[model samples]
Target: MTAHETTLCTLFAEVLGLPRVHPGQSFTGLGGDSIQAIQVVSRARLAGLVVTTREVLRSESVSALAAAARTDDRTRDRSGPVTPPRRFGPLAATPIMEWLGELDGPVDTYNQSLVVRTPAGFDAPAAERLVQALLDTHDVLRLRLPEGLAAPVPAARIPEPGTVSAAALVACVDARFATDEELPALMRGHMRAARALLSPREGTMLRAVLLDRGADRQGRLALVVHHLAVDGVSWRILQDDLRTCWAALASGAAPAPDPVHTPFAHWADLLRAEATSGRRMAEAARWDDVLRPAPAPLAGVRAPGPLDPETARNTHVLTLPPEFTGPLLTAAPGLVNGTVNDVLLTGLALAVLNWRRDGDGDGPPGTDPAGGRVLVDVEGHGREDVVDGLDLSRTVGWFTTVYPVRLDLGPTDPADARAAGPALGAALRRVKEDLRAVPDKGIGFGLLRHLNSHTGPGLARRGIPEIGFNYLGRFPMGDDRAWSAAPGHAFALDDADEGLPMAHAVEVNAAAHEGPDGLTLNATWTWAGNAYPGTRVRALAEEWFAMLRALARYTAKPGAAALTPSDVSLADISQADLDSFESQLGELL
Candidate 1:
């Protein structure tokens, strides 16, 4: 390999914590996701190699990326610190408006939490200072949700320097346990209390608790923020910034202010404008069809209505071990020019169809009467490149867009292994095309549905899918063992309030985490307990896994993964022509 290619390979290996990376190995194939892609972009810039996150996603191999990378810094010096938009009064973001429309009960449980092991030698006092600094720095953290507002027009105030400390926002708990068995209950109690302390109305949007397990053991730092204030990407920014501030404080120096970020309030204003713009309004009919017909709850739902917090909820977790996960995450996605999400959804489509056909009581009986179609509400990180001068790379807030997608796999049959191989491959390709066909990663859907008066009401009345799926990207195993998620805490962010309403009948949340066990894909299947039995959910989960495993195995064969027309954005060829060309070219080769 050339020197440039070798350097790029090393960066990928270091970022992904792999033993080594060859030029032919693509980033996504090695279990890299959007977060890792950003890290690569940062690390490459520091290494004096110019590679954007877009390039990282587009190029198929390290060699291709190296060849395209610029040696000089022409593009590097073209940018400057982005000044945040001026402080506006109350503003509403797309996701916030959608959330407010669904509000039916107590707002206390509508928060997100993250518990991480504190840095070595870090005390509670230092942690408290760090939390205060974060609250002062991130505008969304200081937002106030006044009462009697139909829409969630959250107002945020800029705190003067040295005036941002709220003693009640930070608490230290003594839970020095000798064994790990007590950690779960202890952490849960502290987290629940911390969550209760959060109220947007009171301008108390964030609370931090440090679980002091003593000097001999690493402590857990629990952070709870209102969901309106943070999303998946925001957590990444907060985690990195927290560590940055902690390191500064540890060295007896005040942390410097972060590079200017596009404020949450600014983005919210843009969304409101974009929601009513002609561009978004033009896409209204497309979105209307997507959410036109909501699927019925699985054939045997005990209660046939929307789920609520009062209803009992249950979860079933299924895991794909590192071995299968390796191919499933890397090679399988490469075949269809797809993402891990596309592959998983393909398997889910087949599983739902087959499970229902078998009369397992989890799916429609026999064949799907809708001709093998299932509408699923999919979530996306809503940092789209729609605006010309906007940069949300480091901004923090709830930028999630939940939109509906209909997976149409046309009358699938639950065949034996031999027949299923071909069937699964075809389903994967079809699903990828369906997802690629979505407009702007489903960002505009929420805008038209919530912000535009003309389209909002109709979109709202169209109803939502019974199922929801969110692929929360990959969390690669890094060397920073001291700062990762604290082990032995509660499974979710916070024990959701019992009074909170369930948005979907069934929701599947999947994320791949790298650890000593290698890459393991863990999916949590959550449902309303009163509606579906645990046994039935488990059966559906198993079927989904079976289909995923089949896909992984199928992709292991030669020429299993093929590029359909959708994979080539500029190519206007039909699928049939592409298939014929591949076959003829294979014979010649």
Candidate 2:
């Protein structure tokens, strides 16, 4: 490594609290997220290397950043304590946030939960220290969700790490947990979840615990925070930070402190300004016609069930087989000009269409979703680079983008294994095209609806999509289990939002989990049992697999499929059209 690279390596090791960092390691690969990127920029400036946070984020790799960093005579001090943002501003309603305000029903249940059972040797103080570091690192942890637009909520300043919170200890005589049997909502986490779920107010959005099961010496360490404070990407950075902090604490070394980024409050101020601006209003008006119609309902697969208002959602879990999993994920994306999300959703659209045409029309009143096209509530990470100079990739917030997607599959034949492959393949192609046709990946829809400064009657609210789709991408945790140093420390981590509620009628979550064993794709469908039958739900699951199988079969032959338009290629125009245009130009020449 050159002198610059060596300096960066040392800086990252010190800032991130790692023993050492590889010169070639990626910022994200080393568990360094966007917030940490700001710290790096500030620290580098102090060291006389004037670099912007955007530069650090774009560089990603340590070696690249080192070469990119230039010493400026205008640079300030070499080092100083990370300070909290003094300014306060309200963030405009993210699509999900605005929708949450519109709903009169369950808001407390709106949560995101992750549970991990680690070995006994893990200390409570270590865990507490880890959380303190988390709160001190980002001010979003203390962000309060507003009840309505009656008033704006002021942003919270980041408190010192040592002063954040004192770890709470509670005793449970025998903590029996099982994945098969359904337990009472309160019994789930016993400590971390039950309390937070019961009363999930602002300033107390997150909770952590050290659980001990009698004298068994086997314990579980847990951290449960409301969704408003974290997202899929945020969790990745938090997990890595926890592990690093714990290691430093255990080894009797003072943890290297993280630098403060462009504060969430500042980002919120900018978002609010952008949302109400004339430019944003024009942007909203532009999307009025594109998303005017709502998605078709899934009333075709409705089943009879009791209307229990309290118990609404049911979760069904499915794992793809090992043989087909890897190939399906890798092969289909290239063939269909899309992603795992596009492929799976296309199959779902086919399945919905198939069910509508075939299932007994036993839907409740207005529940009939039979149509040639289907609409869905799609969820994106909401990290769109909408504003220049803003880096949200590593910022922790409920940065989810929810918008309607209309998939026009035209028509489908009745369910037949022999014909399923071709039919699914066609639907996948249509889905890729329909998705690509959207402007800026559907970012404008949410901005117009919730954030635009001016709202005209031109963009009135239509009914929302019944089916919600979200792909969690992948789990940050690898297969290497135990957190403790000892051999007997059995450990397991899981992502869950059970007993928690969503605004949508049905939500689908899919994630690719990498482990010591291999890659496995997990699909979780949660629905209001009263609205849909168990039989129909099972069938819907089957349709997703059918689509994957069809995709795999079509791509089985060498050169059977072409790259998806999503893979670094310009969209809207097809290869054949471009080739024909070029040929005509050649003839004219």
Best by lDDT: 1
- The collision pairs in model 1 are 335-561
Tens-digit lDDT track for model 1 on 1-589?
A: 9988988899899767789999998898777776667667655655667676767877889999999987745345556785548544565645554654464656654788777877646677887778877776777777765662244355434343344464778888776753556765687788788887777667777888887777777777888888777877777667777777877887889864364346777788888889888888889999878765533445211222457453333778788988878888888888876788888888888877776676643345675665667788888877776787565766677788888888887756656422446677777877888998898888999888777889988887777677778887776443346667766543233245666667677778888877777888889888865556778778888988888788778877887868788866666787667778888999999
Clashes of 1: 1
Q: Give the TM-score of candidate 1.
A: 0.88
User: Each model's number of backbone clashes?
Assistant: 1, 8
Query: Tens digits of per-residue lDDT for model 2 on 395-428?
Result: 5676677777777766554254225455555566
Worst 10 residues of 2 by lDDT: 485-494
Q: What are the RMSDs of all candidates, in order?
A: 3.8, 7.8
Q: How much is 416 displaced in model 2, in angstroms?
A: 9.0
lDDT, candidate 2, residue 272? 64
How accurate locally, in lDDT, is each candidate? 0.73, 0.57
Candidate 2: clashing pairs of residues: 46-77, 46-78, 276-453, 295-375, 296-375, 303-533, 337-564, 337-565
Q: Score candidate 2 by TM-score against the native.
A: 0.71
Model 2 regions lying over 4 Å from their true place: 1-93, 117-120, 145-163, 168-202, 212-219, 294-296, 299-313, 359-372, 410-426, 456-460, 476-478, 482-502, 563-589
Q: Which candidate achieves the best TM-score against the true structure?
A: 1
